[model samples]
Target: MFDRATTFGEALEDPAARSILERYMPGIAASPMATQFRGGRLGQLVALVPALEDLAERERFFAALAEVGDGAPRPPYDPAIAPDPAYEPDDVARGSAPATLPGPTPLWEPLELRFAGPSHGNPFVDVELEAVFTRDSGQVRVGGFYDGDGVYVVRALADTEGPWSFQTRSTARSLDGITGTVEVVAARDGAHGPVQVDGFHFRHADGTRHRPLGTTAYAWTHQPEALQQQTLATLADAPFAKLRMCVFPKSYLYNADEPDDFPFVGSLAEGFDLTRFDPAHFRRLEQRVAELGALGIEADIILFHAYDRWGFADLGPAVDERYLRHVVRRLAGFANVWWSMANEYDLLWSKDIDDWERLAAVVGEEDPFGHLNSIHNCRPVYDYAKPWITHVSIQRVDVYRTAENTDQWREQWGKPVVIDECAYEGDIDQGWGNITGEEMVRRFWEGAVRGGYVGHGETYYPPALGLEGEVLWWSKGGVLHGTSPDRIRFLEQLQSEAPEGVWDPLPSDWDMPWGGAEGQVKVGYFGFNRPRFRNLILDDGGWRIEVIDTWGMTVETLPGVQRGQVRVELPGRQFMALRLTRLED
Candidate 1:
């Protein structure tokens, strides 16, 4: 908006443009990005909106730019106006609603309203349906999804206790102008609805703490029946509260095989009908997800991924909407679902930032339960501060300092940080899949004590797990060979004992010293450092210190230390940590 230059050349050279670029992207704005704009493809500009420090100022800058012209952003949905139910559709049917949802729906559980719609000329693309559910709290406009067989469904979440009313609007006469009412009851114990971001921490809808000790098993569902069973069984006792898996099969470095089944009905060739979904594949996935929920694991369902031999990653916007809508209908109903937009969104070379946003809108429009949403990264982290993103799902770009930057990321994003993919633990060929188990455990402790959720993965050498030489754990998810899982489980136990289970990053003096709160508890992790003894100056006395051999899996409490100027001893080895807690009495 600052001095609109008639030509791209003038705009790139303008001092005003330079200032604007420095404020957002900086450094690159005047150089490569400016050159990129000069060459064309200006819509890539909206990706810079996340870099702005002020949330309100981004709107001011966008107000003047042309629609996708010179990189102007396509605005994300305003949570307020986007949910309003005032918009009317073409026809309103004044017919009897076919025996609504049986009885009272549980609070936070999805109350699905089904309708019969026209099956003419590709129902997935032609038909459009929406609903508005109103309670004393407010009204939310939810979009309807087609379930393959001329059936349209709308799922809505009840936030409060008591009766909630709703009205349906549709483009076709089959499912419009109908209204219904249902009672909302309390949520089942331990079923805390969906997970939400609560000020740098993740919590359940019922306000219960969710100390996320997560792990990744990418193509677990694509494995054999016996292997899949083994993975689920492993998860039952594994120290993971959250699991990251893909909706689509992964085809990458180690994994070269096709999945057991694809989500779509047709082949992976171009021009295939994405509108028609494979119900069998979805049914199988739903079973697995339900199993995960029963085992108390939050399912971080990755919708789109780039590593592919199939054409699933290259669908257009219209078909993408259909795919996402069905996904919301089928998966979002689960209380343990968290939507990861893509595994590495940037790698989807066909998709721009705007395309990803449109898909995010479909999630917001269809998922009434408001599940936690985030997009993971490969190189540069997707601007995690975006409005649509609920938390930071980070795949560490830096090999050595990924988990170490947990505090920095938490401070920057002001959201719960999940280091979703920091390298894996194994003796495999790939650099990413060959870190020692000790380093993996050390990474978890580093992120754990720094108030970030670190994710784990295993990729041991093949034939080592009593299986074929090619199907590795990182890709196949059969069994665990590394020792990091047990160590990570121990970290979870330590976090559970604290009332303030969610940790916050504090200023570090030693090898990254972190505190639970206002000096109630403190942890100092000497990652690769090995100091025998150190002197601590305490302002207040009653603090107890324990020597923690993180990899050795031992906790030894050191006694006979006085109030001020206490002496603390350590193992003087790698992956050693010290836990200091102030005694109540």
Candidate 2:
């Protein structure tokens, strides 16, 4: 609508509306008209008029434009068409008739976007749109032709809701080539402001989902009481079937010989007495185990990284094996306990493995407790002692940095794998590197439950209670100790309610969208651990079957199976599921 300047121009027979326009737009009144309008924060602006209008009115406004600055870059203005007066939602549904409207046809121009701010995380870009109009309706949409990445967020604002739709057109080329379209409906309200919307979606070049392995670590050493309390709270709220507790030998902590320079000491071991085996230590551990049991939590204790100063040298023939026997005998009585032979014996000297094997054999002989036994490998050394070990606890290290290598370890082990310790050095100083709080949660859930590996949760360096310097290793005065209680809750919620049959593989690799084509292979698996379901069923094509044993070994396979695919299904969430195929197959 023209301002009061239109009437004034007509009354005075002034060829232009410059006199009235000058008051509102100051710099444009100059003789040469040096003022210019830019398509900056204010998106492309346009003026519209009914076609039936007289040229006298148009000439007045257009001639007034002559008073504006010359040689200045002025944004191109496109007029928009008015909505069809007869168009109605009900009429369209009935297929009765087509609606018509007045005014010139609307024109759309390519939107130019600029980086307005830094990205929030990896591969996320933030942009700002210029040339926005305050009164007219405008919209913008984005998409990629290739499928590597897609929109992650979108937002819009308006005085009132308006009709609009976003379109994402896919292409076979790189993700960068994708294009987006935004179609805005014609509508207007004098008082209402322009509309804006923001949102995002995930897409892959080949239309396949990018599912990465995730894992977590449970390093609760500094505040035993607080850890136990918080863990109990987490278990009560969410379901966590397995938990790991690191048990350092005496040499690793409270070393009077090197009190000032102990490698990883965090605090003095609570109730640790090297002179004699104390009943209280075991009792405290038992109490903790009982608490875990009350909330359906199971404990996996580390027996390798000794807190004792004697270290591996004391494990030779000179030290009677009876001493080791007594240690396991006293601790094996707990119901919720699983034995982890060593922390990272692969990293330790080969002599450490000898001592571990001897100790493991003795513990197996003496305790005779039907509990499960496994060893946490420092790297991927599951093949070294497979015959003696029940299952291999592969420490899937720094998954954020070395995610690509995970599949290699899983393939070689060919056994049920538990990511015993998964974490990054939080002290690296790059604001937690590429991993984020949300990604951390996703990694653990995807790696263990989705990827079919027994996943453990871990946080970096635990805080030091009063036990600083003498008992614990890697303690930082309570700054980094204890479990992220909220994270546990989130994990439990996600795992406890995962889809049924999620642990089983698809009917066949052929069932996948891109099964055999190059760069088209898709691999995924699902499994869980819970009291409700305990058995694992592995499918060997055409009705063939095999059962996974308690030790996680595929004991037997039906002969003469023709199916190339294997499907494993368990009854409940406590089981792990894995599905793997070549990415480019």
Candidate 3:
């Protein structure tokens, strides 16, 4: 039986009053509030007499509490407990291959547990924890839960100075209880004499887990000869089955004037004459593809943006449909290649076209080989292209300090989606610009894979010779840019290692929960009542679990509840993933 009014008064008296005040009345703290009492008194409440200030504060605070009423249950809170730091990796021998870590098993296996509770007042916070073990060659391999949703594996050189510790934090919800577990195993590797694995498992009554859905690889837009060789070497190290190459003619066209400035060009103008389109560069690129194929990489080429031409205006009516068809035919000959019809057709609207229909029509007719085609849509117009294109590619931008429009795009276009490009602004002081390498990886996985999208698409960290150097209209100018060979290898490995066709269980309708009408399942948060609830049929073994927050940070998980209908809070943007397994008979 908590007293709301008393609790409110006590809360005001506490040292955390400033935070609470900022939360409830952000402007009031900075600007004085004008109040008119029962006697028609007029004054700025925050600036007047001290006695009135105390009285007004008390009254405003209690009035807020009165809305909740006494006996309102306090939300869950879990405190942060430091993880055990005295762990070491199990040693492996000098000549063995890396093995797949065991999957999450039933509670019977020996588990090393680590747990942390919710922060003070936040209803939700992300829960991320990992365990690391050292190998004989001094590399440290890591396995852990990322943001309490996706499980990841990392191979890195270990620090000899100290024992490793695992850390987990909830990105969204304030959890009541926290727990973790780990089990160690010894194995051998060729490069490292001995390798150890600390098997990890994480659980939260309110959290869900998601497995990697698919893999994607990107081609560097431009590079120095030495750097290109280095880039190819890095690509060789990645485990990607599919690779995307930015095969636009614009790279050659833009660099033609400054041939010496071209990073990987043998002879820029010679390789890129529209009338006599050279096959030499394409041949060289093909050779690279063949090299990648030996290492298990499949290639997809950007068929648009040749010589700065994306759509009608850029290519112009003079080029005619015949030339386009010829280009498609030549590209289709490559056994390892697939066609990405356009770099971003949505931007074509500015090129004087009313719609994308004309462009799609031309490619549809010209592509006789049935090359797989997809369109990259500018961030604001992805949904508009859904009906026109075979697949949709989303370009995510930072609108506020947060990832802009992801939840909205997912809600609107429930199709195969890819994040084609993403980045913070050039100014690092802006909260949005401070994204980390780790956060970038996390966002890509969450937005594209776990969010039920098709694949994680990418825009390269522009080089000194490519679009960044010439396309001043959209360049960010090195604020937070550049990708190393190691970065590409990491992405390649992430793509190759992820699972395929992972299920995403977001109900088709956000406002309405699925009710079991014939063969659907009902889903909604507790205490939210609506007549139209349905259940999803698990007849096909294709079901995977995902949770969408109707509101930010607030989710409903009942005690002892294995399965039930529940609604999620959805004010701020957030989502969760749960790995679904078939029930035993």
Predicted candidate 1 versus true structure: per-residue lDDT over 1-585, tens digit per residue: 332222345445666654554555554565665665553222224333355324355445444333223554333322211221322243444443352453787776667787755565665556667788888788877776666666677766656778878888765655667888878888766677677888888778888889778888888998788989999998998988998999888887778776657788765444345656776788788789879988989999999987777767766566667678878877776778899999877666457677888889889878877889999877656788889899999977777778888888888988888999889998877788889888888888888878888899888877666666576666678778888899998888887766677567766785556646657777778888788887777658687788888877889987755578877866577878777788765
Most accurate candidate by TM-score: 1
Better of 1 and 2 by lDDT: 1
Q: Candidate 3's residue-wise lDDT over 1-585, tens digit each?
A: 212213223433344543444455445433444122111111222222233235456356435444543345644322432222211123422112121333332221112222332222211112222233432334332322211112222212222223223332223222111222222332112111111111111111112122222233322434335545655565555433455555543433123323132212234445422232334444455566556445444455665542332222243432433345434433443333445655554333222132345555666654432334566643334333444454445455544212224445545654444455554322234343344443444444344332323232322334433434422111211111322223333433333332321222344345322211122222222113233323433444333333423222222332332334333222232222222233333
Q: Positional deviation of 348 in candidate 2, in angstroms?
A: 3.4
Which candidate, 2 or 3, would have the higher TM-score against the true structure? Answer: 3
* TM-score of candidate 2 against the unseen true structure: 0.40
Q: What TM-score would you give candidate 3 relative to the actual structure?
A: 0.41
Worst 10 residues of 1 by lDDT: 77-86
Q: For every candidate structure, what is the RMSD over all alpha carbons to the true structure, in angstroms? A: 7.7, 35.2, 29.8
Clashes of each: 1, 80, 64
The better-scoring model by lDDT among 1 and 3 is: 1
